[model samples]
Target: FYKHMLGRKVIPADLEAFDPEYFSNLKWMLDHDITNIVELYFSAESDELGQQKVVDLKPNGRALPVTNDNKHEYIQLMSEHKMTNSVRQQIDAFLKGLHEIVPPELLSLFDDKELE
Candidate 1:
C-alpha cells in the first residue's frame, strides 16, 4: 500500500537485484559526506530547450546535510519523496481516472502490488 514504508533494498536479501558494482557505488556514497547527494532534489527536463526544473521535495530538511546517524531517516524521506510526494498530482490524477473506470472502494480492497 502507498501508506506502507517502501523497502530499503540495501539489505543482503535484495542483493539479487544488484550487481557487485552497484554495491560498491553505494558503499562509496556511504563513506563520503552527504553533500554527494545534493542532486537528490526532484527535477525534470524543462520545456525551455535544455534547462532543468527542480521541484523541492519538502518545505524543510533539504537545507541540512545528512549525517551517518540520520542517514536512515534521509533514505526513508527520499523514498517517500520519490514515490509519492514528488508525483502527488499525477498519482491523484491517475487514481481519479482509475476510480472512474473501476470503483475505488473495490480497488482499495487490494494492495497496490496486487492491483498492479
Candidate 2:
C-alpha cells in the first residue's frame, strides 16, 4: 500500500530490496523535520517520469475500503474494535468509495441495511 501511494508497482522482491532504503530515507526526513518529503519525492519523480504519471499524494483521512466480499472480515474488525461511531463512519465512507469502484454485481453482497 505504501508502494502504491508512492506510485510504484508492488513487486515483493523489489519491495524487499527497497524497504531498507525507504526506512532510512524516511528516518532522515523525520529527523530533519521534513514535512514535505512526499511532495519532494513526487516532484523529483515527476521530473523523471512526467507530471501526469506522478500523482500528488495527500492524506484523505479515509481507511482502505472493505468490499462486499470482505464484509465478514470488516464485521470481525468492528467487533474487535468495539465498533465506535467514528469507526463506523470511516468504514461506511470506505465502503461507499468501494461501491463507486467495484462492479455493481460484486458490490451487491454488501448489505446496505447493515451499513445503516
TM-score of each: 0.52, 0.23
lDDT of 2 by residue, 1-96 (tens): 222222223332332243556444534443453333333321111232333333222232123343434333433333223222213455566656
Single out the weakest 10-residue window by summed lDDT for candidate 2.
41-50
Q: Write down the lDDT that model 1 would get.
A: 0.48
Model 1 ranges with Cα > 4 A deviation: 1-59
Pairs with steric clashes in candidate 2: none
| Candidate closest to the true structure, highest lDDT | 1
> What tens digits encode model 1's per-residue C-alpha lDDT throughout 1-116?
23322212234213223345544554555667765464443222222335555544445544555566565555545545544554566767776776688775665576634644
TM-score of candidate 2 on Cα atoms, chains taken together: 0.23
Checking candidate 1 for backbone clashes, the offending pairs are none
